[model samples]
Target chain A: MDIVVENLVKRYGNVEAVKGISFSVKHGETFGFLGPNGAGKTTTIYILTTILKPTSGRAIVAGYDVVREPHNVRRHIGVVFQDPSLDDNLTGYENLYIHGKLYGLNNTLLKERIAEVLKFVELYEFKDKCVKSYSGGMRRRLEIARAMLHVPRILFLDEPTLGLDPQTRIHIWDYIKRLKDEHGVTIFLTTHYMEEAEILCNRVAIIDRGKIIALGSPDELKSIIGNDIIYVRVDNNIDVCSKLSIDGIQSCKTIDGETIAIQVRKASEAIPEILRYLEKAEIKVKEVSYRRPSLNDVFIHLTGREIRDSGGGFIDIVRMRHRVR
Target chain B: MMESMYIMIYRQLKRFIRAKSRVVGMILNNILWLVFFGLGWAYTLRGPIASALFRGLDYLAFLLPGIFTTSIFQASFMGGISVIWDKQFGFLKEVLVAPTPRSLTILGRAIGDALVSVVNGLIMLSLGFMLTSHLNPLALPIILVIGLMVALGFTSMGIAIASTMRSPEGFQLIVGLLTLPTTLLSGAMFPLSNAPYWMQLAALVLPLTYAVDLIRFHLVGISFLSSVYWWLTPEIELLLLVIISVILIFIAIEMFKRTTIE
Candidate 1:
């Protein structure tokens, strides 16, 4: 295992940010924590990176205990923080050079690594420009380059493409894929974007309310919600949903006052049975639609709420700042 | 460990050099004080009473050491504001997560800021040296040494304060409250001899007073505190400054260790 977290918990005063979560990552594998904002993803990353101490339990990164042997862990792992951490006063090259030196890289090797990483991130032409002058995407790319300068065994990226344009985000994703493919680096990423997790990670842990509610490969997790979803709009959703325990229906949920979503083996076979059951129950069906289950459906199936709906409140924003910054 | 320290110091130097307006502003502010305040006061105090207070040396020479030491103190203390900047901008995380010892970060910052402070002091010293005939050219090296010590002590003090602050405005406010009184009480603008007993007592405890007196002794062949405490020799004063600097450096390092992300 490259990283092992066992029964880890972190509390800030009265709030438990990370509540007794445990997971492990294999060597050279790309793993991800998929969650909404303020779901303890950043807090967990901080503990594993040895920047924040855990309230209880333990985490071992790169075969070293995070609390007892943080220096060793730090030497072996590289991190790209959720926020921009580069020195805006320095040029892109200077930032990388300083990072390389802090990691105790010798001058000749440091220079070579700087050049290679900068080129890898496609920022070689902007090496001499001050980071303050670089655009947001450029800054993030530079930060990624700086993190990879020493060629650490494990890399942690927190919300790597948050608040970025779609094109820039895909570009960053490409660089991240290259890092794992070419360098054989074990990547541990935390992101709220479902597609980012589905596309980048070999496996993912779905965290919500400070706990990993589901963990598996994206396909495996999606399968947990059943292979297909049937969204049926009816005059009486609760009544129809209560009557949806027919043979083909795997699970049933009332989405709203007028709509209920049904999960089953196959929507083609399940929809006709669900409609007949609703008609037999004297419920008037308004509309019916079926589609393949995505990660969003899995999240709603498990948590009973959309992943994006749990964030964006004023208090959530404050709590997020407290946990991450 | 040493590599981290060197890298931090190198970063500070690079920042100082890149911020050209800041360097020019520091030098210009001190020069304005010397040209207007020093020259103006010198003309008003040309008689016997002024001569007795300054110990028969020109008033500009007496004020020279005070200005030099004050600029170093100001520059060094202001250096701590960078700690707050690092916190606000998120760069502190990078330093904190590095494998190097935590203390080395503050140490490197103090030394780096101290070097910049000394350079600023030297510019003021050189300009003042040309305006006054009482300063000896050979005393320049000794003055530089004294300024460096003062710079380190106050730079450490500044970093300590900054580590606890969250915003630049708050740090600036605290620096304002601190720098004005320390400068005034240390007798950087006037002779402490004719001041009240309380003011003299305050001056005696300030490290800046010792730094000014030592530099003044080398430049104009006199010490202000000698009249008050005849037993407080130059060697003892320098040793006291060294002790104070070391203590402040340790305190700064300890404070930095407690700095949280929030």
Candidate 2:
């Protein structure tokens, strides 16, 4: 194993941010922590990266205990935090130069690696421009390039595509994928974006409220929810779901206030029975849609809530931390 | 460890040079103070009693060394604001997670600010030399050494305070509150010998008071404390500043080690 975490826990005053969660990643594997905002994903990453100490527990990274050998773990891992860590006042090349120096790269090797990583992230042409002038995607790409400058064995990315457009997100995903394939680097990432986790990670632990509620591969997790999903939009979803009882339907969950998603073995057979039952019960359905089970469906099935709705509070906390009371 | 220090200092100097407005503004502020306050005091203190009060040297010559201490103190202390900036902007996270120890990071930042502060002090001294002829040109090297020590001492103190603070505005306010008392009590603006026992006692503990007296001794061959205590000599004062700066650097590192990404 490249990473072994056993009963890791962290607390802030009375609040338990990470509640004794334990998991591991094999060598050169892509692993992810999937959770909503403030669900302790970043806390776990912080502890593993040795940036934040765990209140109690043990995490070993690159065969070194995090608490006892933080510097060793740091030397072996690269991290791209959820927030932008680049110095906006410095040029892209300058930022990379300093980071390389921090890692004790000699001047010649540092210069060579800076060029190579900048080229890898496609930011070589703009290396001379200050980061303040770079667009959001450009800044993120530069951060990734900086993190990759030392070429560590493992990389930790916290919400790598957050607040970025879909096109930019796809571009970043391509870089991450190439890093894994070309360097055999083990990747441990935390994100609330279901597509991000599904596309990049081989195995994921679904965390909520400081606990891993479910853990598996995308297909295995999706299999936990039935084959098909029927999404119902109603004026009173809770009332409507309570009245409908159909055989093919495995479970009914009110995803949001007005939408109730029903997991079923076969949508074609279950849809008609569900509609008929809703009609006979005198509950008016505004709209109905059906699709194959997605990771979002799995989350909704397991938690009765959408991750997107609860996925945004972390950014607010970042802003709040910057403000003076 | 040395590599980490070099990078941290490199980043600080890079930012210092890039901010053209800050560079221009700081120099301009010092020049205005030198012209208005330096000349105004020179004119006001030209009488027989006032001349005796200035230890028989020109008032501008006496005040120049003090101005050097003030500018260096202000600039070096203000340099700590970068810690709050790094914390706010998230670059501190990158530094903390690097393989190097935390103390090296704080020490590098302090040394970087010290260098910048020394440069700023030299500029003010050069400007003062142009306005006054009483200073000995040969004393420049000794003056430079004392100036660098004062800069390092105050810069480390600034970093120590900033590492514990989160808000830049709050740090600025606290530094402002500190700068007033330190400048006023340090004999920078006036002779502490004529003051009351309590105020003189207050001035004795300030690192800037020792810095001002030492720099004045080199620049004008006068020492206010030579009559007060035989052992409080220039050599001993320099040693005291060194101890204070080293202690402050250690404290800054301890504070930085406790800082988290919360």
Model 1 ranges off by over 4 Å: A230-249, A254-260, A264-290, A309-325
Worst 10 residues of 2 chain B by lDDT: B223-232
How many collisions between residues are there in candidate 1? 0
lDDT string for model 1 (A127-147, tens) is 999999999999999999989
Q: In model 2, which residue pairs have backbone atoms overlapping below 3 Å? A: none
Question: DockQ: which candidate is best?
Answer: 2
Task: Evaluate residue A308 in candidate 1 and report its C-alpha lDDT on the 0 to 100 scale.
Answer: 72
Docking class of 2: high
Considering the two chains of model 1, state its CAPRI-style docking category: high
Model 2 CA lDDT for position B112? 85
RMSD of candidates 1 onward, in order: 4.5, 4.1
